[model samples]
Target chain A: MTAHPDMHETESSVREFSVSPERLRLTPEAIERRIGYGDESAPDNVRAAIEEMLAVFDSADPFRCGFRILDPGQVAFHPDRIVCGKVIFRTGSIIGRGLKGCSALALLAASAGPDLSERGRVLISEGRELAGYVLDTIASECVEQCLEHLESELAAATASWGWRLSNRYSPGYCGWDVVEQAKFFSLLHENFCGITVRSSGLMVPLKSASALVGLGENAERKDYECSLCDREDCIIRNDG
Target chain B: MKETSSILQSIAQCIERGKVNRASPYPPDLRDRDGADELVRRAIDLGIDPQEILTDGLMTGMKVVGEEFRAKRIFVPEVLMAAKAMTAGMEHLRPFFASSQATHRGVMILGTVLGDLHDIGKRLVGMMVEGAGWEVIDLGTDVAPEDFVAAVERRPESVVGLSALLTTTMMNMKETVARLKEAHPETKIIIGGAPVTVAFAHEIGADAYAPDPPGAVDFLNSTVAEI
Candidate 1:
């Protein structure tokens, strides 16, 4: 139920946290892996594209993240809906089971800046498909790094309470309905990290991701629960 | 003729290395050298057939890219760069191709189904197919069943490809395949993306499913050969 001291005071009901780009340090190897290269050396052209994309990301400080912490006691779980404080989440058994033993929950949203997505659009328009693809992939990595940063911050904040952290669970993964993203967003301030949910439940910027992390003594700390799902093409599942 | 053949071979090499033109700085070894664009143009100026430039130069290079991609020796960024280089060479030959002075292997209509704005996979498939000497009519993202049906009607001989990145949006692909099949049962339909699998393709009654762009190209080639 406690908010981080670094949260920016807003006029709206939502609490906002300020996350810097310094925290989201993406590595070349990680970027390569995300683009499906794995441990193998990327081709020269692919490596060059990654370098160019890293330069673009370096010149701009466009990463941002916002989150809110909720007490587990305030969350109510049902068959098809989860009520967290004032917000109601229309989730399923997957999310329900995932968050079972949490003393606290962190609702987070992060983006790799709007300009990154804009640059992708411009590159696509100019027929720079390679550049666009690299940018998009890098943006995804950047957002993931932002989540990593957020998880570290949460770990630090909760260590005093002897709480362990569960890996982040995102809507649209592990059978959680993507439509629940609207409810997750409702708890955050408007324009949180400059990411907007589309009518189709897809996040705008196309590179933004929202996730929930459980914090408690009993929370299981492990890699993503990909084995529980049937998505055959999941990169995380395949990598594991 | 020997010089012209050499130029075509150079163009193919440029594409494999992802050198777009003299102005492009990629593949640092090829920096400041005439790339696919110039080499392709020079081949045409030397009276090399436009179709020869396409088949012997662009398609040959893309075939290597496809093989390497399938083998996991290269990834998306590499394939995309090669596609860009192939596109640079193809631009010069478009006029000849449109005038029927050059021939394409077949036509393909590609798109991401409705409610899905993700098109990177679809675009990659389109580029690879185009580089493989197929005429690709990209319908872009959020394409409805009607748009696909309309495009199929316009190019009755064309194959159709549907891509979707989200599990939620993947249902739209099934609906699109069903509609396309009901309307033009003879048209070949291929589906792919992050969430699509061969099993899903079969369940949806799609003609084929490719896990990646190169696989899509291979499917298109095999299907067209059957016809």
Candidate 2:
């Protein structure tokens, strides 16, 4: 198989993409962690279930991401809103603080595809609630993995310009209204990576994610976002 | 030792390890051995009280699973398998339970509030609560406030649980809570989901907020005790 296909062609449309699943691999521990297992050893049955679901994931071509680097001239940040090209975002304190210093921005959207979500629903209909839950959790992690891979690609690309990529910030994080998901989708091409933003700002496939990453020389990086938020019982905080 | 007690203990072990039946190939060590189904049947044949089989056998195993889940010693897949094993045993006792031979700890009405299609959290809590000895009435996802009211009208003493995974649909949960409170002010309402918070629960006037399935089980048990 080709290491990374430059684009994915589908019956409905074609995706002109940069990051692909060629470098993406799902680890059992990562999926287990997303499903609420920390460092604890998974039981025999749970491990078997993880293996079973992993086989399904391996067989299905369920991952894709699309991104574009836009010039700073096309993006403007106001006190309450951000205008990137034709798309506008209602900004919050966290987003303003994160995007403080940047020369350009990278708008990215990623999905683990609809097949995984469909499989999860099928499991639920079959009364396999556990299997369904596991699938959902794994799908969530897969999108994050896609984001991580995108970041790596962005980081390398930005380094060539003596710039760094800021942490990926999504609409729902840090007081940003989730309604901006529509705005994010508007900036991207139609059905980009098969992720559709619902009217309510929720994404289809239920496991897709969209975010903005600031690119500049002064962009800061953190080990985790726990310190910036007030979620006291966050598993990431507990892990630390 | 009474033969029934021994059989009940074995059944409880089978449920804890997620051994469904003699034909199950899981938990390789127990493959080709009597599982929860066979032991439950043998206990029934030995005249073990169905209620005792439920509380001492199925519920006992589930309690351990719940505690382990709380401690993060196990995750969803393991608890689900345990639920499956418990279901295998419960299937044999369903008729007896329906005939009023088995007593439930309490009645809980569970659903994913309207406009929310997410049911994974609701189902986990339902299975966990049922395993903890409650009779759970699961109203599948996209349940409206009127549906909750009608279910509450049928069982006025039942506690209600609402779940929503979206910031958008979480507003619907608030509406369902408000409607249920207006119709049955005394009914306890517990809310949970990915976007739900303790502050949000208080804002929505929910009686309690459960962060996980075990937390929900604990909340339900405590609420039942209060009543």
Candidate 3:
């Protein structure tokens, strides 16, 4: 994708976006789907639990999202590696194939902050496992919704410049090694969006997500093809 | 005096229906009815056999839950509720087991392997195993292999359950299992997670692999039967 002449930028740019809990809504159906409740509605007690958690969420502000956009000239895609700016990401073949033909990469991170995660942990420790589990599910859903909102906004902005945004692929999912999360994080400012990767490669706050999206004329935003990936335990595949 | 059989049956019913206490408003169908909490306390006051309460009441109800979960007739929420009700009943029985007046079916040590901070699945297994009348010592998440070795050393007879959510962390799970086995070859280790499979379990030399909490419970129960 060629950058608009008027939009010429010589270096990577970082953008921070804050999303309110209300702005990122989750439906009962979405919860049911995430819990793998296929072809059946959640039980009444489960619905009651969800309603209670939603009430808590309604008053909570836990989402913070930010991304560093690498200029096309500084991005390179190999058969199994992604070079963004000065960093090399061994993202494996699946991500390589996904990002192929793209001119730019957006390394984005979204988190459900720390409060909600702490609350969920406290609930579980207090023997309220169902409520804690429900809260965790809601947080995951919210983070994804935040990412979707960011993606939609970027698509609109890039579409005006005749560029397409590909589907975002995370480090831990598909064939991408999660250890590359360190390299991915290196491209962003310290604690961007208040997210941090542990030595084990687990993102702190636990309810956070990081991914890379390709932007180019050939970049396609297609439905996630679970079949193309070998990770049968992926939440998206299980949720779908 | 209430017929003991009827009370035990009621306790099982309360557990299966997820009626925790009289005040619990869950499972609307059982609202305002005596639940597992009251039923279990009443059973204990009446001098019902604690083992019988565990085997015939809590375990029986949880057995149905396990089968339902396996068949996909119920999901995690239902299982969670059932486990909660079972917990309420188990509280009344805890004193007996603690005093050796009653016995657990077995013991199991559970944790999310090192590098994996995910604990929801591990906690679910702990609840299920405890509900099925086994003593569960949950080591929590991000547990190193040495921790597993130490825990197993303390409770050599206990079955060990290792969990991991990420593929990268699953490697840590393999390492944890290997270390535990090398230290205590007699220890039976069961592994589970999203990425875990029967083949992977075999490859890792684990005694078993369960895809869900109920599967873990069933596997533990089968091991007890084997013993």
Q: How many backbone clashes does candidate 2 have?
A: 0
Better of 1 and 3 by DockQ: 3
Error of 3 at A224 (Å): 4.3
Give the true-structure RMSD of model 3: 2.6
C-alpha TM-score for every candidate: 0.87, 0.88, 0.92
Q: What does DockQ give for each predicted structure?
A: 0.49, 0.45, 0.62
Give the distance in Å from residue B129's predicted Cα in candidate 2 to where it truly belongs: 0.7
Model 3, which residues run further than 4 Å from truth? A1-12, A231-235, A238-240
- B1-227, model 3: which lDDT tens digit per residue? 35889999999888787889999987888889899999999999999999999999898898888788778788788888888899899888888988998899899999999888898788778877887889999999889999999998899999999998877788887888889989999998999998778888999899999988888987898898898
What is the Cα-based TM-score of model 2? 0.88
For each candidate, the alpha-carbon lDDT, in order, equals 0.81, 0.80, 0.84
Off by over 4 Å in 1: A1-15, A27-30, A37-52, A58-62, A76-100, A186-191, A223-231, B1-5
**Whole-model lDDT for model 2 versus the true structure?**
0.80
Docking class of 3: medium
Winning candidate number (TM-score):
3
lDDT by residue for model 3 (A106-202), tens: 7789999998888888998898888988998999889988888878767765786677888889887777878788888888889989989976678
- The per-candidate count of clashes, in order, stands at 0, 0, 0
Higher-scoring candidate on TM-score, 1 or 2: 2
